[model samples]
Target: MKILELIRPAYLEVRRIGNNIRRSIEYSLSAKKKDIKIAISTVLGYSEQTIPKLINDLKKYGFSGNSIYVFEGGHNKIEHSFAGYHYYKIDHNSFDLNGLITINELNLNADYWLLLHDTVTIGKKFKKMVYTCQFKNFLGLKLLKKDVSMNIGFYSMPLIRQNSEYLHSFKNTDYTEKGLLNAKERGAIEEDYIFKNSQNIGYVHYDLQYRVKCENDVMYKGRLRRMEYYPQLDMTKYKANFVTDKEWIIKL
Candidate 1:
């Protein structure tokens, strides 16, 4: 088991390389040209150290400066700033129901907005295709049963700058849910409220792995094994690839 553990990272690296190559080829062959601008935004509450890494990874994937917007939530103020990116600090006490407040505050001027969480890492081809695709309302990934009421961490929302009233309405009420379960309920309710009224929603499935903290309070070397809900669905149709550095021993 120890030997297998030592070999996992190398194995995952090889798999990631292969996946990247395949995705790159597919993207090159099928990518369509579009005259649209995309702005990426993320709401950060606690992961200050992880935010820079996320930004750097996005830059590595060819995202231009100032194209990404970071909205700081909670009491933590980001000390580091990157050029060509916009940053806004929202008071921790603000009425944010699963980042709605942060999302509402942004002046999303692009044709599309890619909403992300700090933990998610975007692939190069995925980023390119997302911008090039003509879908007006794209859900980057489907929510699991446990997340049925909430929106996935990554989603693409059509940006309509002229329709400011709809966005401003999110700030009208505060989320009353207290704990984690209730918070998720709040998210589901809010997302349903926002998405149910919209037309033509599409889904693009992709792999999204989680990074867990070790007992030492540091991020583990590999991906964390995702937990299973009551009845698991066969997600094979999504063609999502998952690779973690560690074994499937640790539970998230």
Candidate 2:
């Protein structure tokens, strides 16, 4: 038993290293294939620093030459010159859900429309895996689902366009009960209604590493956490969504 225990750590370490190498090779091969055309849209408030980092991160994951539509809603504006990737900026005073609605209004063109939060980073494995799923007939993959909210911040296009009417209804409201119930009434399936049923969605994958970070603190789970100092804008127009118990460090 003592000898077996002594060899266990090294064996596990070797396995971990081998797994890492395999994942690396898979990521590289996926990047090389690069057949999907994804248009990324995100609401940017004061987190201008995150935009460039996000674009760079996506490039590393093989999302090259894609269009990035940034809806700027804060006092500061974000401008980028990343080649091979098309970037557009829409100046707006909206906040939260409204900003996302503004992005939808643009009607950008792409095979898939990816909605993302400024603070959350897309994982390489998650991107590659979702890329293989069938997104044409069904709704896009749900990146983060919590409680009754589907957290539209990390979803895709035809899904966004197909459900525009219902999504636009939440422009001035929060993504809480009313928005969800409305979605269900409009023909959204149980899997589409909440984040808890993500596994039932088939094409969706939950990536814990796609996290929200504030300062040095990070919440490896849950939807992206908004910064405290960032203005809530029109979030008060609707009922507040439930806050999770996940730990987040706010830089004040």
Candidate 3:
């Protein structure tokens, strides 16, 4: 190996150390001390049944998700209690894009915003991988999905700064595309746009591209169609005819 290539790893380590120290000094010297470094935001639908379990897991790491501001899109109120967790009733389903917009209006005071998918299950590696990133415009569990063709695609959470360009990007379909698609596709397209124009992007130092995947008891796992595999879930929500992005079959 060339001498430059051999020294690159050492160079990166030095940079990381420098950045961490600079970050610490900046936080310490700031006039308004931010008690919370990360503000957690999420959208809830049927995810109500799963989030508390994830919250419990987060506690094991000694990382409290201070003041979880959730946008509730379901008819029912959240029934679990965790400190610093609150939900606001909204007029839509548990869609991430709208939830993000709603969260934006609140103007949370934190060094970073951590957006989370309710069904996503993260491991202990999550804390270290995420906390180290303080200077990026975007940080997610992974990069946008790419194929062998080197195509960048949709991505999701963990956060954006309070004054990011992304917070201003989601107005309507007219904001990007000329015409409108479904809400899901519109959000995906918006995310891809953000990825393409990424000012500064970072990823969690994960072994796999995605260290965590959506997981709940019989979680809905599909890009298109869905199946309600959990027998314990209320099937009454499906009895009436519905037009949805997913065609869910009551397999249970």
Give the Cα error of residue 157 in candidate 2, in Å: 4.4
TM-score (C-alpha, index-matched) for candidate 3: 0.50
Q: Write the per-residue lDDT of candidate 1 for residues 166-221, one digit (tens) a residue.
A: 55544322223243334333343465444444444443323433222222322322
State the lDDT of candidate 3 residue by residue for 81-147, as single tens digits.
3455555654343244444555555554544445554544455655544444333334332332341
Position 242, candidate 2: lDDT: 19
Return the TM-score for each candidate structure: 0.50, 0.48, 0.50
Model 1 weakest lDDT span, ten residues long = 231-240
- Cα RMSD for candidates in order: 10.9, 9.7, 10.9
Off by over 4 Å in 1: 1-45, 75-84, 92-103, 132-184, 189-193, 205-252
Model 2 steric clash total:
1
Residue 104 shift from truth in candidate 2, angstroms: 3.9
Model 3 CA deviation exceeding 4 Å by range: 1-44, 65-67, 74-84, 91-94, 134-181, 206-252
